[model samples]
Target chain A: MNDKLVTVLADVFGLRREQIVPQLTKDDVGNWDSLKQMDLVVSLEREFGVELEIADIITMTSVEKINRILKAKGVDLEA
Target chain B: MKLDGAVSLITGGSKGLGLAIAHRLRAEGARVIVADIDNVALEALPDVFDRRSLDVTQPDEAKSTVEAIAAMYGRIDVLVNNAGVIYSEPLVNLMNPDGMMHSYDRFRQCLRVNLDSVFIMTSAVVEQMVLRRTKGVVINISSISARGNEGQTAYSAAKAAVNAMTVTWSKELGRLGIRCNAVAPGFVDTPSTRAALNETIIKHIEGLTPLRRLGRAEEIAQAVVAAIANDFLNGTILDVNGGVTI
Candidate 1:
């Protein structure tokens, strides 16, 4: 599950899997604008088979926040 | 998406081309809501359509109306941005020497109706679609004038901008399962068209078109239906002109 999340983040941000750390954030990525954020939302939703609410989407500004939100939504990210 | 039982909204749909599109969508089994600023026209509409008064140029009005529709219908499956005026004015009027150039006030007015309204309404509707996780469709009514028409400076510019926005939104929203496309009609036989052009100019345009006739409003509506039905059709400016190019 962690590898899958990293793969989605890497694909959406156009970075390598090794670079997709939990500390990574919108400010850390040059291309992470509003549009890219939406792309990330779609990617995460598809990769995790989850429907994200607008509030969850807004708060998902970093990898750590995304992991927390997924866990709260009942996605078993720990696996 | 499937049209049956889908909630559809058509702005400026109380009459003319918009009304035609609304009728077609209803025939396809969609729940049709016709919104226009014309109260008289709204009242005159048949009992089949849900009527609402709307000024698409107002952002707050647009947002509230969209929210109301979503609350009532559960979700908005389709949005047809068919509200616009057919304005024509030359960049430079050789006959009117006193004020040879087109008025800036009129230019802004045209943009407000044709361009800004699209932005406002689409933003509101897409917000609902995104929030509800609805796979919605946005159909913008463009014009062949978008390719640039003579003596239609403001109209042409506004439509060109509409086309640009259509493409931009399609790219931005595709992943969310929302589709954006436009129907660019040629000279259609409608009250607005007749009001905008005299018989002589209309005749001249018909001669230029390969079909030697102005397009019917129903035919333009057919194009709108096609745009909605075809799921793969995205970011397209479907020109329903009778082989006329400008």
Candidate 2:
């Protein structure tokens, strides 16, 4: 699950694979602005096929938060 | 880029020009979805085309409709923004002292249904296409009234904006390989038109037009299909209005 997310962050944020650590927050990412955040949410939805709410989107500022939200939405990350 | 297997969504597809476009696309083997605000009209749709209840003017509804359609089909290849309403009244009523002026509500409703709906639906669908990295096509149904027809102040403004956006969208989305264009039809002979205009008005319009007759709904439909099929055509507003230059 972390591996897939790392790739998405790298692809969307124009970061290297190694830079996309699980602990990386929005403040740490160079290009993570409000617009990119919206783009990230859309990309995540398209990637995972889960309809995320606005609350979920706003709280998904870090990898852990994203995982927790996805988990709550019944996304089986382990698979 | 064949119509076969392509997923196309046409708004206002329950009747008039939208239904004709649906039929044209369906005949070519495209998987089509016709969405309208009217549930009764949707119920009347044939089994070949999918039907859904959609009020394109509402922002949330527009977004969800695109999402739901994309979920059902892996991708949406085409979107025809055909849902619109026309209010044929002067900005101010001067004929009768008792008559009220064009109320703010009516003007706002016209803009909402005719102009704002196109913006809302296009943004939602385009975002989906961008995320999926899909090269898609968008055809906006404009009108010859965009050239400033009398008694259509609100409708003309809305349609003129649509034509402008067609060019702007083509420029912005062309980088992503998505094409955008519009079709401007003039006085198409539809059931709604027949009921709305009397013989004198119809005859006057026909006399002014080069073709000397009102356009058929199918004629406009053919133009839409042709625009979609032609890959090189982009940002062009194909006018099918019998050369009635105003």
Candidate 3:
């Protein structure tokens, strides 16, 4: 799951895998704005094969938050 | 992307253009839902089509209705924002003796129904599409009047805005695999138009148009279905006006 999340972040934000950290918030990332947030949402949904609520999308600012939200949506992070 | 077994919601589908679109889409194998504020017309739809009573202008109702449909069908594959009203009063009626000025209420009501409702309903459905990663199509029913029409200031403005937003949404949502397009029909021969428009006015419009006659609702509906079927036809307001705007 972490590897997939890193790939999605790297692909969607055009960031290096090393740049993606669990604590990396939108504020820390230069390219991660609201519009990019939506891209992230789409990428995450497609990658994880899980639907995400708009509320969850809005709150998903960091990798940690995304991990929790994906788990909440029944996506097995350990898989 | 195929219409077969896809779920579609068309607002204002109780009669006229909306009903025609509902029929056309259903015939193409879509599971159709016709939503309108008129309960009577809703009740009269055939058993093949699902019917829902809704006032699309209310945000809460829009949210709840979209949620209900998503719950039932698992996704909304198509959304036709067709609910709207037109008021043909001039910006100022100087001939009035009672001194009833062009009221704000009239203009606001037109915008509320025509413009605001589209935004509200589209947002609700697009959110669900975003969540489910559904490649949805949004068809906004626009009119030739969007370019300009005499004494139809409010209606014209609202439809023009719809066209603008259709383009905007197409750009914004295209990357998500969702496409937004519009069908701007010319004056159509419907029961309401036949009753409300006089012979002289109708004749003048017909003469002005290249086709020399008003369009049919079925023709407009066919254009809508075609728009949805075409994968690359996004951000375009397909003017189904038969060269009238020319």
DockQ of each: 0.01, 0.01, 0.01
For model 2, name the residue pairs that clash. Answer: none
Model 1 agreement with the true structure over B65-134: per-residue lDDT tens digits: 9999999999999999999999988876533446767899999999999999999999999999999999
Candidate 1 off by > 4 Å:
A1-79
Give native contacts recovered, as a fraction, per prediction.
0.00, 0.00, 0.00
Score residue B201 of candidate 2 by CA lDDT: 66
Model 3: fraction of native contacts: 0.00
Clashing residue pairs in candidate 1 (N, C-alpha, C atoms within 3 angstroms)? none
**Quality of candidate 3's docking, in CAPRI categories?**
incorrect
User: Native-vs-model 3 lDDT?
Assistant: 0.87
* Native-to-model Cα distance after best TM-score fit, residue B70 in candidate 1, in Å: 0.3
Off by over 4 Å in 3: A1-79
Computed on alpha carbons, the lDDT of every model, listed in order, comes to 0.92, 0.86, 0.87
lDDT of 2 by residue, B11-105 (tens): 99999889999999999889999999989988989999899899998899889989999988988999999988656766644332254367778
Clashing pairs in 3: none
